[model samples]
Target: MSVTVIRPADRAAWLDARRQDVTASVAAAVLNVHPYTSQYQLWAEKTGRLSPDGEATDAMMRGVYIEPVGVAMLRDQKPEWAVEYHADNAYYRDEKIRIGATPDAFAVDPGREGRGNVQIKSASESAFKDYWIDPDTKQVIPPTWIALQAITEARLTGCDWACVALVVITWRGTLRLYVIDIPLIERHWVAIKTGVAEFWRVVDAGEHPPIDWEKDGSTVLDVYRDSYTDVRDLSDDAALDVIIRRYKEAKELESSGKKLADTLKPQIIFALGNSAAGKTASYDIRASTQIRASYVASESQSRVLRIKPRRDHDVDASRF
Candidate 1:
């Protein structure tokens, strides 16, 4: 499969190129499966409506420094395979669908005509134990978002398979390597293309996707940061009416719960006045103090939604 190779001269070039096409990194966003980026946020960024703050994240920095180590460790662990590392900034794009990928490394099986691509990731010990491995099944599965990224990269690179080359960094200053091979699902590619097509269609038509309330709340707030001194009568919105009612009820419960907890904490502390630890019928409580690092928070204003009642109603929506 012949694809276009883009060797970026600098990070700016790479970012610019990434914005032009649906790269493998943000492919999961198109499918609404990515945890970090929502479809709305991706659209906002791609459409130049929202410009991401030009700051490199800690994970991004870690990957930049640990990627070579990850690929090297993978080579050492898989002795039978030939690992090939390419230019870090080389992006391969398929013109057919305008989908592109920047692979971490490529793996070749020696004495065989088979090749696969590797997606390198640096995971903390806790993250590996909690998320990388299935709690119930005890099977290790990389994040679906990253797995999709690897699959898309493999397909774009003309490879047979894709695998996640994970580098688990422990707090004990020890490292662990796991190369989990991902089986190819042909339908996944089809779904990816379909999702990407829909995204591009909306982009061309200047349409915004419906808000993913769960994942896109922060994105919406960030993209539309300005808050004007305006009030509108949203009483006609039945959905918002119910939502606000639930929110108020929940807030009341939270206030009462906090009061109860605060009252109990003093009683428990008094009971444990003479002792540092106390045991109840089903609970063991201990009193302890730890020093915390203090730092000044950055100055920024976040939008707050406040609902004021226009009229009093005795009707209970929750009961209905």
Candidate 2:
């Protein structure tokens, strides 16, 4: 059986149209490439669950913040002749090759100044930490993936120069931009292409390739874990007892069905004070909640002391 491979130029044009459609849409959109299509098919085969579009849609919607930044960077930086490319599908010699990559955002740099691609990622503070590390030396690494993707798009499009622009937006409303040069990416082209070829070979042989982060676990999950410290210093049995107590309390509250605000009364206290000759003054203290007691004894006198829970240090609002 003969196989048909679509010319790269034709593929590029089709991909450009699809990306434009996505940009124009009001809702988040997704455009899947080749190996993903094949992988989805295999997943369906194994799991007997045929709905891949829903999964893809959910994933795409989760990262919609990156789209606007990517689009803006492409329009501002790239050339007029450059077009977006996506790999839609691919097949073996006995089947047609169908692969697509919409280059997230891409454009040719007019006057051959610089062709550029943008890989916009909305990263939390902790996720950005990994990008700042050196991947090889495990030191502070830069955004190499963005550069590699940009160079791949440049080579695929035959552009003179390529740049990878990363727009990382944090949850706290801060945006960080990172740019990578094309030549640095070009140096790794051979390795990248070889890896792709090997990947396809595995796919063509009808074996299910592992998921992108299956080995190490999901990157998003890792980020979520990194956001907070573990409060699990207590043993499992003790933790379960606490959890069970909370559950029982919740159940009792649910049964009563009382308004939450009505059930709990909050008290507020106020104090007025003035400085007098810069002398320190003492006030009466009360014991409440779990607290530690201390004793101070001198040869002439003895005193009993109680310590309250240490509050978080007061912070100046101006720093933020």
Candidate 3:
């Protein structure tokens, strides 16, 4: 595949290169499945709106420092693999897509008898424990997001495989290579290409990807912290109206459920006086008291709901 190359002289140049095109590292974000990065962040980065400063977290620095060690380890395992680092940004563009990839190492004439791209990663002990694999038993458990990243790079470089090398550092300062394997999943490559093209279309149209409140909570909090200074009441937006109506209905249901539970609780508790729990044909119920410290009162006693075995029961339409 023909690609445009941009050689970055330093970190600043590298950051600038990233702004010019979507890189393999951010492919998962474009797919809306990246653990740390949200779709909004990826859009901002690709659109040149996000600042490069403060982009490097402590873990990122650890990865940068440990990458060379990882490369050395990978070389030790496969002495015949010719590994070379690329300081230039590799970008491929066409009518529907503009993508970039900067591989950590490119292996040529490897012992595996195939050329491939190598990506090095460093993760915390907790995170590292998740990447363990067994070549003997053929058990491979890898992080999906990072695996997608390597696959995206392979797609861009026209390589059939990607070697993923990871350095896992423990809290006690121990380091280990938890996994080193070439993952060449065809389905991942196809999904990545399709998702990137979709993201590019969104960029071309000057629109943002839909925010996922559940997944984007941290990013939203960071961006809106002590902000929203020029806030104005929104007019009757139909989309927002749907959300608001659903929210209202949910709250009403919650209130009614709570009221019905309150009405049922005292009667059930009276029947099972001094007994901790009771079971019926339809349900198993338990009552427990909890004492919690509150600001208004030194200590407050509250009933704890402990219900289980929620079997199916017919609803009475006449009651409704």
Candidate 4:
């Protein structure tokens, strides 16, 4: 279904429009596998069980400051493509599913074939280094999670394509900018929007979606952290009894594991002496170190010992 676009002036209006709808930022979470925020966390927030983003991180503040810079750089570098800033967030609604999105900004080209949206991102020096790609080539690769968000915005806006402007802060505090063009894929948007629709349905029903135990376990634990405000003894439920037993066993196993590791750590370190590596028939252990600048110490060096199986070794997997 086509989306309805709204340009609301007030912040409250924009926020109200976003309520109960799947916005671009959490679109990845709806489908799971967002790099940072978990789907369960998003679910909790939407269901009004938890309030998140109460305190913005340092990175968030940095993004706020760098957003204008991104907009300015794009306009200066590409004069033909006029970039217009939205004073308030733009809202889009798919009436069928009640899903919506807001892009960072929109491109104002009088003669363009289809509408275009813009996304601005900022990262720290280390992160930028890890994700850096050559923007000059058509082969420029966007970060997966953020790309999903930008594409979701494009889908809501009925745009054929979108542009992402990435800005990074260097170690010396200088800003670097890269621009990438992303074309919309119908199949991807269909899957994302459909998944989001179902997710919102779960929220409206006051129920949780199917949980990926390994992925959502920590979120579930946090959600129930204060579930029992006061402890009281009661008749035992069979499930609770089994859980208590397992918990005791887990604690014992953890203590044993730590003790064993501690006992062996000194012996291994001492045996290494001045050697950086040790080799066995089936395994190799290496000591690696690095020096880097630190905010508190000015400079620091750290070392770690890593162990791995020999490249050609065929170890028995079932012997654990």
Candidate 5:
């Protein structure tokens, strides 16, 4: 099959025709890239499954939630070449080299005289950071990998330039865009092509190839795993106890039930009350339920129960 060269006008029309479908396709492609796939696959393996499909699978739910959110965030950034939803480009070699990349959205800067093909990416904040920073050196990884992917798509369509636009949507719904230039992209094309060749070699040898990121000086899996482990380790029982108490208190408030403030562990109580009152009184009141009451007698001889409430719940009430 002859390679279909998509001109800027044609590309624009094609994207306008099928935007949503193309965006989903792009999101799926990104998910297949190094760190994303590795993390998901590891999660699946840990849960004793090859695929995240079951309704009960947390992995499946997480993937489902993230992809659409990422896509929406990308669309919201509204790149100049936002193509039709689901625009698909297929390139086939008559003998063998049949591979395709369906970019979520493709745009060209009319102001730049349609010089480059821009690929738009909507990513979770974590994924966005992982793509940039080198896992080993903690430096910014060259944008070559991104540029290479864009170039491959450009080559498939016989375009001269490739641009990658990444819109990172943070958990708080903030969007940030990163653009890749053509010179940087061209510099990395040869390495990406060589990496692809090595991948084919591994396939022919009946072995899965190690990811290019490992050789590219960064691995998403290592970074994600290391960060995850660090967080997990820091959340020890003592740390978690504080969180649990807070959660319980919040839940009780939501339900309008009597707050089980007393059931909160001593450590949490001490932390909450350490600022107010003397430590001795706070400790004495927390250690036992013996209410410390200060009495005031008016000139008329009426007694007032001056109860010192727990630090967090300072409800001052007088019983006559």
Candidate 6:
């Protein structure tokens, strides 16, 4: 497939281009490998139900800020590999798949056959430990999402190979750099297309992807950002009942004084309104908001009872 190269006039145009296509950054989300983005969120963005411009997270900002340093390392390590960093912002796209990627650089290795895609990334020490390292084997590996991003770049640019130039900043404030080549793009192409095709099919059908209950908590809240003030009884929803039961259990754990979760008890109680008490075997859990002299409820309401995947920090060994 012939790839279209577009050097946008400005950042707005670059972002506008991304709105229509499933850009490489979030490509792995469709396959459920992206750590941050969920499949439903990607569907929402592509279908125009949600804004495509997601806020630049700290991790994302660090990647942009430290990319040059990683590229500098890439130059230092492989002097023979001729690489060009596009400062003007060139987007390589394949219209057939409606997929595109703007890689950090394009390279031509004197040792290799053809041009290669270079993806410069910056990860925190913990992220490097978690995603890029095979724990038991201790072998360095590019993350699935990162690999997919590079593959999309290679496919669009007609590159024979893709490379991830990574820089990791440790908690102790040291930098680590590595050059990882993503081999066998042709082998992965079919799987990528399959996932992407199914994603677009759901989007075209105006249907949400299956709810990834563990990862889509924040996404669920965001989907109802502009929800009406009118109350609707969801008593018939069996799924909601299960989710609510799980939420109550989490709240119970929080109230148990295990100290793993912070005090969101008041907030949960306030969300429940007049009836905000539940009894367990050990104790009675009750929540009531104090009224101030000038009493007025805020127009905006906070969504409670979100289910999220537990992070390493959120886990407590003592409880076990």
**For all candidates, what are the clash counts?**
0, 20, 0, 0, 15, 0
Per-residue alpha-carbon lDDT of candidate 4 for residues 1-320, written as tens digits (9 for 90 to 100): 67888888776677668876777877887777577666677786676654333445787677778888999988887788878786466688887787778777888666667668889988777876566554565354777777888888887777767878888778998877788877677787887877887887777787777655445544543343232122222212333333333333444577665444433433333334335555444445554444588788656443344555558755443432
RMSD of candidate 3 to the true fold? 14.0
lDDT of 2 by residue, 37-100 (tens): 3332333223323221222364366455466765565555544545453433221121222222
What lDDT would each prediction earn against the true structure? Answer: 0.72, 0.37, 0.62, 0.65, 0.40, 0.68
Return whichever of 2 and 3 wins on lDDT: 3
Q: Give the Å error, residue 115, model 5.
A: 5.8
Candidate order by decreasing lDDT = 1, 6, 4, 3, 5, 2
lDDT of model 2 at position 81: 49
Q: Report clash pairs, candidate 3.
A: none
User: Which candidate has the highest lDDT of all?
Assistant: 1
- Candidate 2 regions exceeding 4 Å error are 1-51, 55-59, 73-99, 107-114, 133-145, 184-187, 207-320
- Every model's TM-score: 0.73, 0.39, 0.64, 0.68, 0.38, 0.74
- Model 1 worst lDDT run, 10 consecutive residues: 282-291
Model 2 clashing-pair count: 20
Candidate 4, lDDT over the whole model: 0.65
Model 6 C-alpha lDDT per residue in residues 1-320, reported as the tens digit of each score: 76788889987898887777788888898778898888887876676655346567886677777978888888898999898886667887878888888878988998879898898988889988988899999988998888998888788778888888888889999988888989855757777878888888888887779865445544554453332334333334433333344455666676673232232332223233334343222223333223234347533433333333223223232432
Better of 1 and 6 by TM-score: 6
Clashing pairs in 6: none
Locate the minimum summed-lDDT window of 10 residues in model 5: 223-232
TM-score, candidate 2, is: 0.39
Alpha carbon deviation, residue 247, candidate 1 (Å):
6.3
lDDT of 3 at 99: 74
TM-score of predicted structure 5: 0.38
Worst 10 residues of 4 by lDDT: 227-236
Off by over 4 Å in 3: 86-96, 131-140, 217-320
